[model samples]
Target: MTGPGLRREVRAGWSLFRRDMLKFRRERARIVSSLLQPIMFLGIFGLGLKNVLGGTGPFQELDYIQYIFPGVIGINVLGISMSTGVTIVADREFGFLREVLVAPISRLTIALGKVASGVATAMFQVAILLLLSPLLGLTPGFVQIVLLMSAVALLAIATSALGVLMASRIRSVESFQYVFQFMLFPLFFLSGAFFVLDRVPPWIAFIANLNPLTYAIDLFRHILYGDIELGELSRSLLLVNSPAEDILIIAVISVVLLSASVVSFVRME
Candidate 1:
């Protein structure tokens, strides 16, 4: 007979996942609020920058909206991933995490449930953006669809693990907010989400290569446009040869971070 422990773990995991899903559904306003930032960047920033490109072929005709669209997608995922981290800290603060920890369930099961909630949230945000893509002149084909989603899934999981790992050690949510603010914007700009990497100086380019978000954006760009150049003046900025290579590197990072999160939870007990 299967032990009661096994059943308890599964039940707890499902309950946690369902709770988050319901919470996400209830907060419908967040969907609109979250999208506004990306839209603003595309509209205000991109429109202003598009005029200066001198209409180059390598830029796909210097249509700035198309160049920055994938980065906008990154913004959506990063915003949700970070918010999920806040919820984890809130649970710890409010005694909900204590209640869950005391129960007869494996810590891995709980961690996976938490990670799943973050991943689901990101995908929901992505779905909204995918529907809006045509308005920006991005029409992903079937294969591109698969590639795009696969990249999003891998990146989402990695980011969730990172957030969870951070939350695990930090006792207070306020501290996390401080640290997160420092890390988040740097990652966004360093990822080349808003601009082509070609014009960036050598020092900045070197630092960007070390950021995981850089590879994630590379995968997004490759899959979305299929070897097309977002800027004519720039050489190929990809660190990896293909989207598959990018996915592989990110998968490794995800596994490492997920393992670290599991270990952190175990240590917390």
Candidate 2:
């Protein structure tokens, strides 16, 4: 791209990013509702399960919430990415998409703006929960906290790009909703976000390994509670055999998703 063209892309992306962020902040109900589910999982599901599990065996000496907090963060970020896709579909339905489509900037830039907004929303949700981490006995140093946020942002980019790719292919908000519903929970549960992947059967472990969210959650746990013994079953279930490998795999996946989203938009009617 030429210098002027590149500058235009950046400007366009920023404008779209700002617009989405403003809309996101203005919806107080949306913010509360987006957060309510994760908090419920932490309170009702985690606490209820804590009584039954009781830090035994592989669980060691921690409560269930402590075990699942990383997973909850993972779910929260992934949920934001999925919700961003719905906004893209809604834009298409409501006619704003036509204005975006005819803009002088590249389509990829427009897509990146949308993806950036989704990443911000995901980070915002995670930050709110991070403040409550001390109650769950989780704390991280400055560098560790930065890495955790960076890891979540990368995961958001990957998932939101994938969301946009699907959104570009579908015609209506209802059709997009149908496909996203089929995708969301399976991605969350199969990621082993709420439990130990190690404790599961071998076949289940294999299935979990296929999910990209698995690597992101593992990264979160390592950053927050690095010393915990997650065992071979859980560790082996990770697509990356080592920490460096995990980072490399996630970086590659994020790039792939961006390319896919761009191609998908180019082909859209």
**Local distance difference test values of all predictions, in order:** 0.78, 0.82
lDDT by residue for model 2 over 15-82, one digit each (tens)? Answer: 99999999998999999998998999999878898878775654555567887888899888988886
TM-score of each: 0.89, 0.92
> For model 2, what is the error of residue 268's alpha carbon versus the real structure, in angstroms, after optimal superposition?
0.9
TM-score of the candidate numbered 2? 0.92
| lDDT of candidate model 1 versus the reference | 0.78
The window of 10 residues in a row where model 1 has the poorest summed lDDT is 232-241
lDDT of 1 by residue, 1-269 (tens): 17887787788888988999998888889878887878888888678777775365445443567777888888778768766777889899888888888887788888888888888888888877888778877778888987787788888888888788888888788998888888888888988887767678888888877777778888888887763544433435432346677778888988998899878877774
What total of clashing residue pairs does each candidate reach? 0, 0
**TM-score of candidate 1 versus the correct structure, residues matched by position:** 0.89
